[model samples]
Target chain A: MSSRRAPRVHGLMTRGYADDLRLFGSGKAKLGLLALVLAYLMLPFFLTSDFWLSVLDYAGIAAIGALGLNLLTGYTGQVSLGHAFFIGLGAYAAAQLGGPDALNLPLPLWLLGAAVFGALVGALIGPFALRLRGNYLAIVTLGLIFLGEHLFRNLKDVTGGNSGTNVDTTATLGGLDFKDLALLGENFSFNQGYFWLIWGLVGLVALLVKNLVRTRPGRALQAVRDRDVAAEVVGVQLGRYKVGAFAVSSGLAALAGALLGSYQQFVSPDEFSLFLSIQYIAIIIVGGVGTVFGSIVGALVLGGLPGLIDKYSASIPGVSTGSGDSGFISVFSLNQAIFGLLIVLFLVFEPRGLAAVWLRVKAYFKAWPFSY
Target chain B: MSEFLQLCFNGTALGARYALVALGFVIIYRATGVINFAQGGLLALGAYLAYALNDTAALPFALAVIGAVIASGLIGAATERVVLRRMVGQPVFAVVMVTIGMLFILEQTITSIWGFEALNLGDPWGVQIVRAGDVVLAQRDLWTVGIAGAVLAAFFAFFRFSKLGVAMRATAFDQEAALAQGISARRVFAVSWGISGALACLAGVTLAAGPAALSPGIGAVALIAFPAMIVGGLDSPVGAVLGGLIIGITQALTTGYQEDLFGWAGANFAAVMPYVVMVLILLVRPYGLFGTREVRRI
Candidate 1:
């Protein structure tokens, strides 16, 4: 009887490195993932409200961008205020490639093309990261936003100038048109279709990022974040990972921007302002700095806030909806103020953010039998 | 030749305002190692406050400017005390973001009080110009140069001789060593912010001196001043002024010659001119003309 090893606990025990690196090791985890998939497929059908669907769709797009930012900032430790630039780049790319007056490519082609374009531009900017560090890098990226805005306004033919351009692009994915989805003989509305498409892509990005972070390259990124010099001494190629991370992060941002342009059907240069970049930075900060799931979680929480505020501003006290109102400030000012307050409050009180809170809860439950 | 001189004169005036704002940035950075994004917010707030005091309260113009400067200094010190104190040991990224957050709040607070409409600053100088040969200067612009120069000279003297200023320099040199020497790092930080705020107000007053000059958009000049600060070197007061003048002249020249020389660059090219010059300079020097190279960065 002593020769036989005691029965290992299902989750608390791990046999090898393979088990340690498994995405969903326990049966419970696999079941939870299956349930989440079911919910994803079932969600749009029941929650058919246009407003809610739009909110969720936007959240999904923000999730994609935040995921990319997390990979760069949270994992690789590069702060960029130029996210809006890449996003703007993606939107214009979509407009040029997918618009009827232009190349009018299929959905996949245009979207992928936008991502590729963003990656290329991002790679070009990556060298700046090599040259600059910390505050210099941040200010340089801030310059990128202004320079990008200048370009967006001046490049009339491509960007349609400051007046902006429409993006009445198609959303068909080999017979599965996200514009009007029809699955198993049931037709879904435009918002519903888009909700599924965006969220599905979000899931894919989350999975892809998860996989990346779990691998050797992912460890390399975290090492770079922790101590770049130490990482260099330990045989990590600083240039390759740093540049590669930038390319991937910006590529993801462009992907989000393409969706935003297509969904809104209008791509304005002003839409990708420093404020937009700040919003993404705020989202990542609010959600969790470096965690993969935290980006999605943060997006879910903050992505719909502006829309919600805009929708409910009439009822909210101290927010003047129109001209000559009693309230001192407009809804726009209130939203920005709130964002500012949140960033300050979260950083001051909870620097690790909501992800850390969620982890604490999970950890508590996992070790329920013994507090230690 | 007159046109060139005119451009140089105008650029000098513009750069003077930039110098004041960039000096604020340099002081805070030297003391706290923080690039306060909220400096622009403070600039706007100071201008609005001046508007309120001069127009609403009907105070004397000089008194109004003084009051605005003093109030902004208090607010700046209070900000360091209340918010930034919590971020003492945090990384630079977190600290910078906190300032950005403060910026949005401050800007909104200004708008909420003053609204977005461009208002009269109630300045004594109203469309008054002084002609020097073929080059004409607005009284406000001339005063702007004078006030900026005076303030900068005062600051240089203060930093060189004043006990507090020497303490600030010591703290900037080594906070721990300064603390060991019994210098109050906290007092130095608070004083730096207060001094920065006061400078921002003076810049704001100059910027908002002309007729219908006071507006929320006046604050954005601080963002442009970023290039000036970078070009000067983040820590060097002298660099900030020189960088400001260089950028200011370059911008003025670009705008003056837009149609003839920079037609291909599109309209409003002068707005981003400073950034372009900064990039070029950084490519060669990395740390402005006079900034010390970082050794063993923490």
Candidate 2:
């Protein structure tokens, strides 16, 4: 018995740098990826209801934005409340560039245009991070949201002023419009088409971010986040990494906004406010900070919560659906209150957020038969 | 020129209100190192509580104001004890976000309790005006300036002479050193929150006293005051007052002259002028006019 060799765990062992950088680190992870792909391909057909389909579409959009935010705030330790501004910028960019009277570009060009514009603006703002730290940086970004709103409101030619502008941007690429698709001789609805388009992008963006985070710049960002002075002492260029992170994060956010505008077909100045910024912050905080998968999880949960609440508001005891309803709290107020409570409770009780909970459960199963 | 003087008078009155809010921010920030975003909620709560006491409870206006101020102070202290105490050692981002969460909860709570309709504050100085050398000022505005000046004087005196205040300042300067010297850091934190709450109450009362009327949106004034706090330097009380005055004057002047000077900029540009000014100022002095620059070490 003593001479018998221990049973080897094949997929669990990481014996080299190549193994360490593998996207699917273990058998379980590979299986999870396969399951996710299956769900992506098949879930639209299974969930044919318009309500659930739209909800998932919105969640996919939020996931894209949240991934961008997680890159900057979570991995780079930069606190920003101006995400709504960038989102709005992207939406308006789509409106102008993809609209009939303007540049009249197609889906990919407009989305890329919005990202470039967002990156330029982000680069302009990134220098402020060099000069300020902590709370000051946060408040300055808050100011950016207000300024963006003001610009959106007054720029009548571009944003159509207070009444808002219609985003007639098409999601067509290479003779295949996402608004209508025929697969296997079965026609699909707009929501289903968007479900495929948005989630497909979500997968692509996630892969891109995951790859980015595993590389050298990602390590430099984490080093700066842990301690900027120490990072600089260790030969990391603080300005380049800080500014680059902002550019990349804002670019992703703008891409998400372009998708949202195209999907919703409407963009309004009021849509981008302090509350919207707070919502993005809430998503990252609730999802696990510094985890790419956590952003998607958070977006799926918190992003879909408001729509779920709205759909079922009549049944909730104290939620007033209309002005004359017999309840103390309006549906909007209830939603706001829930968001506030979630932020507070999660921060106090589970600082590491839902990702940590998932990690714990996975660890528990991995060490089965005997408690570690 | 007379029109400009009138605008300046109104601006100073507005600045006084901003100064009061900024002062409250400075006190809490100096003591606990947390920028209390929930201060706006406290401000709105104080005004609404005074409204309830005066209109619902049928108390005298002055007495209701006093009662509201005290109650708000206690609420502030209770918040520090209950929620913030647990968050003492967390990162600054987490603490600030917690306060923001509290702000949302408080705002919604006020709306649920008070409803959305605007209510008269029922103060004695309701839309009354006074004239001085061809410049007219609202009675509430005059009272705001006078009261704000008195509060500033009292706070400075307290900081200079009071033993507890000295302990608070010492704690702010260096927490570990103050603790070693037997200063109760927790008490200092609580007291600072309490004082900030009272100041917020006063600012709310003055802001809601005149034609503004008490409403849920009244709390948003604290957002503009954030600019004031930043401009004066986050830690300087005097800087807050100066920053408030500067922002108020700039906003008032912009409103007065936007039609002529900035017509091309767009209508109602004055509303966002403070933010523009803040961005410009921050570009010049990241630490603000009076804040000390932090030293970094590897």
Candidate 3:
């Protein structure tokens, strides 16, 4: 029957508008997504190592932020070196709104509060993009980092000053405490609960971003990114899209920061420096620019690096584990060096990033019989 | 008034160093159309090299400085050949990130070799002072000003008269046009990087020449120079120098008047004063005081 071969993976058949916009158009993709959801739910149970779980948790948090950066830098053609500033803002917002001393709101409220706070600030800063472009815009944003750092350091009450403050916020959702979960009469550790919570949020954010980029506004953003003047000429309201992208991007960053603060239980000004911004940039670069899936892929690849480096530092040669050891480089320096090297190597060799590689593999499979 | 003059003297010394670094930034930006964030790394490397030659190897201070400058120049040129050439046609953001990547690598390399501990630079101008008309100037500061003036003047002269200078300007103006006229873009790029590295090294040497100034943290001055570069104009050498002096003097005045003038702003307001000034100036003059405004053709 023709039904057996009704639809093909790469068939050039007439497709409806709904088919074009479908996230998982192919049966294979839908099945793959189902498999992913199953694995996401089940991974924490099988992989119970505290170290690895924490790594995944952090990676999930970073993925949320990286997705936002991709939307800004990839989709909207804006390069912001002040991501760390916005992240710090979110962290502080969590500390203020969710901490026991402050409003002490629930998990959802704090997270949304932080995101909204970051978005408002990001909107305020977006108008500068209208006046400046390219290198000049980049430098102005760089100033934001310094100014933000100054504020973080001096504003002792809200940010807890340079010494940092505790982020002891409760993470509960409708009588289900993530910090201590009870599922089907089985008690789960904090790590297990966190893995589920963090990854679950990652999935939600990823879906949100994916849907956003598939719509008319998404096309507007891409146009602005490709050529702002042309996009404007073509009736794309440059200001609204640019500012909206920034707000959304920064909101995601703040959400990540809120999670990071809640999970770590502590955050200082030092945690949100220029290096943190660079790290996010590296994540997007190594993952794949302008791709939602690439952001998560990049975060997953780089998220566990520091943990892995620290774990194996004792065995690595020329790595001083402790201060004053007879080694050329300390473990910290080595980790940073590797990060820098990864950025350089990835940019030079695999500019399209790991996502592109995966896409190529998929393409090759799609053209299996007539591979040229 | 004397206190003000003293602060001015110190500011001038600091400004000279910023001028050198900013000049290097201008050279690299002009030639390659990419801001070389790795200048700080090169600055640290050159300063360390000077320290090694002067103290560890027991060479004359002047000779060691010269050797380090030459080495840094060659290293800069080699880096352009080996690493940056591959990134020639990449997006501006990508190229900028690449240099930032280089910055981290270079900084870590310096720390791995030298460790994080502060080291003495062993310059002859140690604690030596010259008093002149209500202002007490360090011998090193005086020498720094003198050297910077001479080197900057020499560079200006070269840029004004030399064929290579003309070639660099031509390439900076229109890369494809210069290529069509038979100018080797590669050579121009490499030489620009070399000159930038040389300028960075000189800045480093001057910075490290004073007592207890040769620390790993010395490289951070380049970050402040960013503001100086922007305030002066990205493409103008004279703008860079002026911006440096403006930032340097503002910082010095803030530091000097911290207790009286900036008490409410909190401690160490001077450290961030340059950025504040840069942002304020940029809001009014987008292209900076001396920067050429871009004329975009759609």
Winner by lDDT = 2
Q: Where's the lowest-lDDT run of ten residues in candidate 1 chain B?
A: B289-298
Model 1 residue B181 CA deviation in Å: 0.7
Which candidate gets the maximum TM-score versus the true structure? 2
Residue B112 in model 3: shift from native, Å?
0.7
Model 2 clash number: 0
TM-score of each: 0.97, 0.98, 0.97
* Candidate 2 residue spans exceeding 4 A from truth: A1-9, A16-18
- Candidate 2 docking category? high
Q: Rank the candidates by DockQ, best first.
A: 2, 3, 1
Position A292, candidate 2: lDDT: 95
TM-score of chain B of each: 0.98, 0.98, 0.98
**1 against 3, candidate with superior DockQ:** 3
DockQ of 1: 0.72
Over the stretch A291-332, how does candidate 1's per-residue lDDT look in tens digits? 887899889999988999999999998899998888988999
Q: Regarding lDDT, does 1 or 2 come out ahead? A: 2
Q: Give a tens-digit lDDT track for model 3, residues B1-298.
A: 9999999989999999999999999999989988988899999999999999998999999999999999999999999999999998888778888888998899999998888888888888988999898889999999999999999999998888999999999999999999999999999999999999999999998998877478877788888898899999999999999999999999999999988965878777898889899988988999889999988654
